[model samples]
Target: MEEGATETPEELLAKQHRKEKKDLQAKIQSLKNAVPKNDKKRRKQLTEDIAKLEAELNQKHEEELKQLKSPADTKVGEMINGVEAMTVEGGDQQEVKQPRVTKAQKRRDKKAAQEKERESRIAEAEVQNLLGERHQEGLKLAQKLAQRQLQIREISSDGHCMYRAVEDQLVQRAVPGLTLVLKELRSRTAEYMRNHADDFVPFLTNPNTGDMYTADEFEKYCSDVEHTAAWGGQLELRALTHVLQLPIEVIQADSPTIKIGEEYDSEPITLVYMLHAYGLGEHYNSVERLKDPANEEDS
Candidate 1:
């Protein structure tokens, strides 16, 4: 082996340039590969960088061609080689264009949007129908209760006939806890509405009718009260409105209990059992306390 072999400055600089160029090419490939299969933003940036590099390479190729036309044509071949190394070393490194959106993908997106819109319409209609039915049922029950009370008052005033027994029978059949049942139903209904509000359009209070409309009735009313705002304010009123509309059946006074029309019209049973089962009967008894205005005033 030679005692002192030293690398020349030109050779060392060429080695350094080759190493730096190789590292830069690797970095470019890594970046190109970093573009996700489904990410539009990332692919967009990669496409930009690829375009820039292609443009620079093309410019260098053109400059090399121009030099080859002059007396200083010796360097042109080196420039051409550099241009080819920069542009074509990685055979896969063509312009990184945005992924094409297929016709099937466009069709899928459109179908999904259509299905969502159809479901929304159906849901809104169902909710509205339910509200209307509850309203009617509550009114019927309220009228029946009021008529029974009037009959009892009339018979009790007579004070000297079989009518007195009839009065007692009517009171017993009235199921002292009916109001409590209504209140419980209201609470449950409100809670259900609260929990599922995201699916609902939103409840809008109408100033003109003092009625509430679900979202979708946008122009006349604010679409929806925020969740926090909707929790309070007219819940009791809304519930009472629903309760007053239940259907009434004037059964024989000997019957153990009145049948609640909504979500329950099953076999006969005690008032407490029925109310507790449906979560309505327990609160019905509290209606009596509410009837005493003096107590309310004190509170």
Candidate 2:
């Protein structure tokens, strides 16, 4: 045998199975010797381990038998000859060698791949359902504005979706190096709310408890919003609008009229209003970008 020669896939797998079986046997013996007979819990755990190891050993044995019954076309010794047989242009008949993979391994890999694809499809369908009419309306609007098709680019629906959505839009508009902008904006919004408590305190009510927020509760709420990954809401949005000093328009499918900021005079940054339902309650959904067909070609 050549020094440091790579083993055939079958040889490697067989070696691994033998090593595992030996290790498991050693573990079982050690556990039996060390564990006391009176210790029922330890005995039970050891018994479970032995059973699991036995099951694995049986599976490996079955695989070995199956492999032996139908021997692989390429073996470790044959691989060397196969490589040597390969010649330059117009030489002796050359055979292409492929790695040997067991039927069980192939089936397992195939099943895993299919499962991943299925999960991806389901996630995409859920996003589409969440967008619903808003997605359709956005597409129509895109056609009217630029005579082009639009595609939705989904953002993460985590608590910071609103800030993240705005950040994404800014990035799309060719803004450079603003990774921490969202965090900064969040801090600024919290500070603004604290400074102007009179304007925001009356509107601060806990959605879950349906009770007006006390000074301490509202303070803690602002702290959570600023420092933690707590979900942003209308209050945060208003603060963000003021801090950014830019008018924002929320376009909703249910409403014909667009919701602009308090000032509503400056050039507006537009965003779609996604709707989602959880049990009996409804909430704002994560935003998706309408990709322009013209921009697609450029990119």
Candidate 3:
């Protein structure tokens, strides 16, 4: 064991260069193994970093070769070996590996997400257009109703918009002692329709057979009107007019104002029928007098 051994700066610099090169390679592999391959931005950044580290490693290798060529610095230590020695020898301990998605798969998923967003935007626009049309109908109907100093009072659309709207007007006319108004009105209308079958029966066609209603079927129809929340329409309106002996005015967008029981001439119960007020089907809203003169609507 000779105690006089000494090392030159060139040899030490070459050892450091080898350690730095090893670190650069590990850093490049770590960058490649980063997660979330779908992140194009992060992938681009990693590509840049790997390129930079590789360039530096290449430049240092050239430097180490030129330094080691001198005969005096030829006594360098053995090359750093194995990933296990990386901590003491430049291992890049913080680097981790994760599974990555294929480029094709990532692109497909991005395209699908973009398509889904486009469809959502389209559906929203269609809904907005429908709302705009409903608003237009409201504005048009408002023009006719304004003459009487009345505004539309919205009725619930729970399959009984017509009956609920008629109930609203009946209450407004100060019909006294009206308990369970909708039930009472429906029962009265059905009874009238049943008794005056000659007037109503010829008007209704059996929906299933496309023929005139049989006696049993007409009775069932009346039962449904009173017992179930069956939707009300033209025939029901006519029956209601005779039952109450009251003129009923139906303001419509498509046709001239309908005057049911117009000959009665007492005051009219006013309602508006909207063809597209609801998405499912036509709907009715009751007419009420404006609360104040300022509430008068122009459109």
Quote each prediction's TM-score. Answer: 0.19, 0.45, 0.56
Show where candidate 3 strays beyond 4 Å. 1-132, 177-180, 291-299
Q: How far is 50's C-alpha from truth in model 1 (Å)?
A: 4.5
Kindly list the per-residue Cα lDDT of model 3 for residues 1-299, writing each as its tens digit: 23422344455566667787676576457545542233243446667756765664575456446534634332222232222221333433553233354565456446545754764575465346435766557556766677667667889998788989989998877876543388889898888988988887787788878999889888998898888989899999998888888899899976899898988878888889999776766998997775453332221
lDDT order of candidates, top first: 3, 2, 1
Q: Per-residue lDDT for 212-245 in model 2, tens only?
A: 8889998998898799877776677778778766
**Model 1 worst lDDT window (10 residues):** 281-290
> What is the Å distance of residue 188 in model 3 from its true position?
1.1
Colliding residue pairs in candidate 2: none
TM-score between candidate 2 and the true structure:
0.45
User: Best by lDDT, which number?
Assistant: 3
Which scores better on TM-score, 1 or 2? 2
In model 2, where is the ten-residue run with the lowest total lDDT? 277-286
- Candidate 2 wrong stretches, greater than 4 Å: 1-151, 173-180, 207-209, 262-265, 277-299
What TM-score does candidate 1 reach? 0.19
